[model samples]
Target: MEYREVELPACKSIALIAHDNRKASLVAWCARHREALAQHRLCATGTSGALVAEDTGLVIERLVSGPLGGDQQVGALIAEGKVDLLIFFWDPFEPMPHDPDVKALLRIAAVWNIPVACNESSADFIVASPLFAGRSQRMVPDYERYTASRSAR
Candidate 1:
């Protein structure tokens, strides 16, 4: 795929998502990073979002529950260039009914070059990077070329 560079704002728009089995871990992770995270815009899938809000008193733009289409909602935001970071704590041990959606969400994040963290250690590393608190640039797929080629097929 062809690529183009885009700038990420110093103050980012971060999306948080988690499966049922991973909610507590995500919420705890959010709480641990509450202060730093408070500086950015936050959005999340339903139940997890609510729990994070209640636990940390940080406001979150809550989408629908994951199985109820929240994954698609977040994916759309990623594709639209709205969300800069994705911290999805999904359960790999158990299969979810919406597994396909989960996979799609991850794929879209990658396609858009959004930073993502799937666990506590990864989250720690991501948030600790100097770039996390500063404006930076990333490479993303050149969607115009991709769309044109697809239409020609």
Candidate 2:
């Protein structure tokens, strides 16, 4: 008899990024995990977001393209704890002019303790984790409260 393990889907705000050449792979991966990913909020760079959104029929909050600061925008979200996970499919074989931005975004994710997936395998590991039990990360202590408290001090 074969044993089957069940992975609890976690509700996570995820950022999806891919280079132009890898958009197709990203889309395919998203399609395979659409059911799980759909339970969470999706944010993506313009082109990758469009591709994933189209492929999975899931709504993605789109940001500017990577070269146009989309990576920074998502990085800010991670820094503020707005995002839970990041899946970036970069073409390491090819050098990108926007490499700095990519590195910055990746660095920010690390600083914020956000999980990142640079390939399909890593993505599978994340989506299959017990922590991801189809539960959303609480957004407590709203931004307004934090800002107000800081101002009072």
Candidate 3:
């Protein structure tokens, strides 16, 4: 696929998601980074968002629960260039009924060339990165070019 460069603004739109078993971990992580997170926009699956907001007092845009299509919602936002980062705290030991949705969300984040942190350690590194503080550039699929090429086939 053809790709083009895009700039992520200084204030990014971050998406948060967590499986049932990992919700507390995600909330604690948010509380730990509350100050840095406050500077950016946060959105999360329904339950996770509410927990984080209640624990850290950070404003969050809540979407439907993950099992109920919240992962797809965040994926759509990523595809639309509205979400810059994805922080998902999913449990690997436990099988999830909504595993497909989780996979799709991660796939979309990769396709969009956005950063994703799947655990607390990665989340810490992501938030502490120098690029996290300012504008950063990333290459993403050039959908229009891809469409035109397909049309020429």
Candidate 4:
């Protein structure tokens, strides 16, 4: 399916991430919205990306493995204003060794004023919003500033 650019702020770039356990749910969810999601750019971490691509037949920009810095890479994309939406189906119940990176990714989205969906419910909320059909410009902080702050600390 060819997903054209929609009006939503996140329609420009959408990041798809899911933990090992939640990969299936994420895949299932994406399959349900394949048509809508196809309208935007899709990115994902190594394993997750591979799995999703295999399951849904969507070409995804694959990054490194999450525990191996994939999450940080995607987070950098968000900080750099390259990503507009983040859909991360994380398993909060399990402790991840790379939790810090994941948290940082989510925080970067927040710091940059981008919309992020951490769970299935929020993903639905974001995808269903009329704004998803209308492109809206949002003021975001400078990527340099965020990087500088982290460096300073």
- Judged by TM-score, which candidate is best? 3
Q: Estimate the overall C-alpha local distance difference test score of candidate 3.
A: 0.96
Per-residue lDDT of model 2, residues 16-110, tens digit only: 99998899999999999988888888999999999899878998999999999999999888867678789999988989898999999988776
lDDT of model 1 at residue 64?
98
Instruction: Give a tens-digit lDDT track for model 1, residues 1-153.
Output: 899999999999999998888999999999999999999999999999999999999989999999999999999999999999999998889899999999999999987888889989999999999999999999999989989999999
Between candidates 3 and 4, the one scoring higher on lDDT is 3
Q: What is the TM-score of each candidate against the true structure?
A: 0.94, 0.81, 0.98, 0.84
Candidate 4: worst 10 consecutive residues by lDDT? 1-10
Candidate 3, 8: how far from true, in Å?
Answer: 0.3
Q: What tens digits encode model 4's per-residue C-alpha lDDT throughout 9-61?
A: 54568889999889998999898888888888999999889988898888799
Number of the predicted model whose lDDT against the real structure is largest: 3
What does candidate 3's lDDT look like per residue over 63-100, in tens digits?
99999999999999999999999999999999989999
Minimal lDDT window, size 10, model 3:
96-105
For each of the candidates, give the backbone clash count: 0, 7, 0, 5
Who is ahead in TM-score, 3 or 4? 3
Comparing candidate 1 with candidate 3, which one achieves the higher TM-score?
A: 3
Q: What would the TM-score be for candidate 3 when compared with the true structure?
A: 0.98
Ranking by lDDT: 3, 1, 4, 2
